[model samples]
Target: MSSPTPSTLRVGRRYRAKRLNGPYDAIVIGSGIGGLTAAACLSKMGKKVVVFEQHYTAGGFTHSYDRNGYEWDVGVHYIGDMGADHTMAKRLFDHVTDGELKWAPMDANYDRLFIGDRQIDLMAGPKAFVDSLKNDFPDEHQAIDSYMGYLNQVAKALPGVTLAKVLPNLLAGPFRRLANRKAPAFLNRPTQEVLEGLTGNQELIAALTGQWGDNGLVPTESSFIIHSLIARHYLYGGYYPVGGASEMAKTIIPVIQQSGGEVFTYADVKEILVEKGRAVGVLMADGETVRAPAVISNAGVYNTFGPLLADNAPHKAFYQMKLGNVQRSMASVCLYIGIQDTAENLQLPKTNFWIYPGTDHANQVDNFLKAPDEHDIPLTYISFPSAKDPSFAARYPGRATVEIVAPGPFEWYADWADKPWGKRGDDYEAKKEAYSQRLLEKLYEKMPQLRGKVDYYELSTPLSTDYFCRYSTGEIYGLDHNPERFEQDWLKPKTRIPGLYLTGQDVMTCGVVGAMVGGLLTTVAISGLKGLPLAKKMFVG
Candidate 1:
C-alpha cells in the first residue's frame, strides 16, 4: 500500500537510462479510453507499460476528425457524470491520469427526441427531465415520477449489479449480500418489455428510447439496465471534452507516458504474441515484436481473442463461441459537415436532436433494412461540435461543424468492405449523396436559416469506419448491447488464459463513461486497485 517511488512514475520516460529494465509490465493493444485507463492505472502502480494504436491518433471511437478547418467527433459528442464532483467516471479519470483531462457541460437539454411530428427535449436534472416529459403526456405524471425513481434506483444498484457478473463465489460473498437483486433481475428483460410494465403510453416510451441506436439495441432488444444507465447519465446533463474528442486521449497520454509507459499510434499489432499458452507480447504489423508480461486488449472481444490469436492459440474456441452468439452493434452512415457560418448564427440548439419518422422504436431497423428506400432511417441526428467546445472555434473561426449519423446496414457497403473508401465507386457516391441530402433537408426543416451555408461535407460509410477504426464489421459500439449481451457471464475484464485481458466497451457497458469504467475494471484486475480498492479509496482519497 506504500506509494510507488516517484522514480517508478518516471521510469517509462527514461527507460534506457534507468538501466534496470526487463520485459514490459504490460502491453495494451489500442489507446482507447479503456486501454488508456488501464495503462495509466498500471503506470501509477509502478508497472512499465506500452500502448499500441493502429490509427494515426489514439482514442479509438472517441477521436475526432478535421476537414476544411472544422472538426467533428468520430464517436463522442458529449459524456455524462463528468460534471458530478465525485462521480465514478470523474474519479477514475482523475486518479488514472492524475487530474489531467477537462470536461465541458453540454447545453441544458442533453438530447431532443422528435417522434412523429413532435419535438421533445430531454432536459438536464432529474426533476427537469421528468417535468419535460410531463409536458408531452400530462396524464402520465405518476408514470413519469415512477420512471425517475427507477433511474435513481438503477444508479445505486449498478456496482452490485456489475460485481454480480465478475466476482467468483469465494470473493463475492460480501458483494452479493450488498448487491440489489431487484436491479439485475430486470436485466433479462427487454427495454420495451420493461417500459410496458412502467407505462402504457406508446409515444412516451418511443421518445425515451430514441437514442437506443447508440447502444445498437432497439427498445425490444436492449436491456432495461442499459436503457436506465443512458437515460439517467444524461439526466444530470452531457459534458463534452473541452478540446474536443481528441483531448479525451491527449490528456491521459502524458499521464500514461509519465508512468513509465508509452502511447504509440500507427503501431499496429499484427498478432498477439503468446508463450506457453499465455499472452506475453504483441508482434506489430511491421514485424517488430515488443515483449511484455501481460496484454490488455481494448480491441473488442471479436478481434482480441478471435482474429489476433495464433493458429493454436489457447481458449480460441471459447472466445469464438462467444463471438458466434453475441450480436454486433449497428454500423452507421455519418455525414460530417463543415459549415461556413458560426453555429451561434445558425441558432443551433446545444442539445442534439434525434428525429424519427414514426414512434415505433421497435420497428426502427425493420423499416430501414426491409425497405431501405422508404425507410426514413431516424430522419436526422443533429450535433454541433462547435457548440460543445468553443475553443475549437479558434481553430476555424467563422465556421461550425455539424455531424449527422444514421443506421447503415452491412449490405449497403458489403461489396466495398475490402476496398478503399473514396474508391468505392459511383453507386456508393450516389447512395451517400441521397442520404446526405435527406439528412440535410431534415436539418433545414429543423433549422431553416442555414440551408446553403454548408462549406463542405462528405460521407463516412461503414467502409470508412472499418478502415479508420479497425472494427471487424464496421460495428460502432463494439459488441451489441442487447438484453442478452449484459446477461453473458463471459464478457468481463479477466481472461481464461492468464496474462491476457479485455477492455473497451465490451468490458463495463458502453458509451465513453462505460468504456472508461471498463478500463477501471482491467486496472483493478492488473494491480489489485493500486493496493487500495474503492472501499479504501472512499475514505483515503
Candidate 2:
C-alpha cells in the first residue's frame, strides 16, 4: 500500500483535484445497501459523510441495470416483510425517508416449489402457509403441527440470537451481559439437526426446508437461526419495488445529499489508510486520497480485511486464518431474456419458482455444487420483473422480461478471474452460450410459449460476479450460511482496526432484507443510541 499518486479524484464530498480539504465526519467505502443505509442514518443525524463505490452504481448486489431496454435486478429476487408494519425492512426504509419509496407486493403465494413432480405453493401469512402444507401431508398433520411449533420457537428466537452475534465487543459493557447472550445455545446445531429433531417424515422436512437454496445451504449445513429468520420473514409477506431494484439506491441518495453527504459510483477504494491503528481514510483507484474521522465499509468481510486493508494494521495472521475458514455463498448463472408477449398469455406467475431434483435437501446442495443440470437444476429462482413492476413493461413496450437463476459452480470459470469482464475469450463465450441455451431449454420446459419469444438472452457466471463485485471467486452473497460460518465470531461488522467497519451481507445474514438490516445495525453502532432516531421512534411508535 502506497500513498495515492494523484490522478484519481472522484468524490461525494467536496474535494480539489488530488486533495481532500480535511476530514469528514465519516467516509464509507462501497455504496452497498448496508453502507448506504448507515450513511443515510448518520446523515439524518446531521453528519457530514461521503460514500465511495467502485462500481458504476450503488446498491451492491441489489443494484440493477438497463440491458436492451429491460431493467433487471442483479441479486434481488424477492424481499420479505415490506407490506406489513413492525418489520425492520418497513421501518428502516419508511423512517429513513419517511415513506417515499413505493413497494410492489409479490403474489400471495410467495414461492412455488416444484419438488419431484408436485407444485407446492408456500402461501403468505403464518396460518395460511401452515394450512397449505398440511394439505400436502394429511397423514403427518400432527407431526407437521409439531414442526411448525419448532419453527415458531426458532423464528421468535432469532433476534435473541443477535445478542450472541454482537456481544463479543460488549465484553467491557457489563458482566451481567453474559445473561443477554442467547444465540450460542442454537449455534452449535445445524438446520437438519434441529428439523430432524422435530419430525421423522422426510417429505415434510423437505417441504419445510425447501427454500434452503435461498440461503445457499443444505438443511444439514445451514444454521437453525438462518432458517428461522428467513422462514419467519416470508411467512408474513414478500415484495419487490415498483420501479425496479435501482429505485432503492436512487430514492436514498437524496437523504444522503440533503445532510451534506453523497454516494458516488466509479469511486474505487484501493486501500484503507490507517493512522496509529485506526482507519482514517482510503486511497482510491484513480490515485486520490481522502481522509475522514471514521470509516465504514460495505465490502464483504474477506475483501475488506484480506485484500483492501491487508497492510493497514496488525492481526495479519488472524485475518488470514478467519479467511480460510469462511466460505462464500453460491454464485448464480442467471438467464435473463426479453420476451415479446404478456405473461398472462404465457401463464407466468409472479411467484418465484423453486425447482428441486428430489425431496432430499442434501442432494440439492450436492447438485448445486456441480453446476446447472437438466434434472436437478436444484433451484430455479425465476422472476417476472415486468409483471411485478409495470414500469418495466412500459420501458420495453409489448415485451416482458424473464430472469431465470440457478447455481453456477466456481470452478466453471477459474481461468478468467484476472481477465476483463465479458471478454473471456472465444472458448469461454462459447461455453457460456451453450450453458445459456441449456438453461433456456429447461426454461422452455416450464414455459413452452417462451420458446421463440426471446429477443435477448444472456447468462452470468460466478466469474462475472467476481469481476464486478471484486470478491476473490465471485461468491455472490458473501459467505455461505453454513452453521460454522454463522458462529465464527470473527466475521462481525466491527474490525480489530479501531476506526474501520464492515457491512453488506457478510455483516449480518444473507438476503436483501438481511443486508439492509445489517446496515441498520452498523449505523446503530456508529451513531450509538443517542443518535438513532428510528430506533427510539420504532420502539416508542
Give one clash count per candidate, in the order shown.
1, 1
Q: Summarize candidate 2's per-residue lDDT along 286-347 as a digit string, tens digits.
A: 78888887888888877787677756366656787788887877777888787767666667
> Which regions of candidate 1 are displaced past 4 Å?
1-22, 165-184, 529-541
Candidate 1 Cα deviation (angstroms), residue 508? 1.5
My TM-score estimates for the predictions, one after another, are 0.92, 0.91
Candidate 1 per-residue C-alpha lDDT over 1-541 given as tens digits, one digit per residue, 9 for 90 to 100: 1322322211122222133244689989887878887887778778888888887778888777665556778888778878865766678767765777787888888898888888888888877888888987899988888777777777777767566544654665556565645554554578898778888888888887877866776888777888888887777888888877877777777777675678776677889988898888888776677788789999888788767998699989888888787887888888898877777887776788888888886576687788888767654678888888868666567778888888787678787776665687787788889888887888888878878888788888888778877786788888777767765667878888888889888987888878877776777666654534642352124
Name the candidate that leads on TM-score.
1
Best candidate (score: lDDT): 1
Candidate 1, lDDT over the whole model: 0.76
Q: Clash pairs of candidate 1? A: 12-260
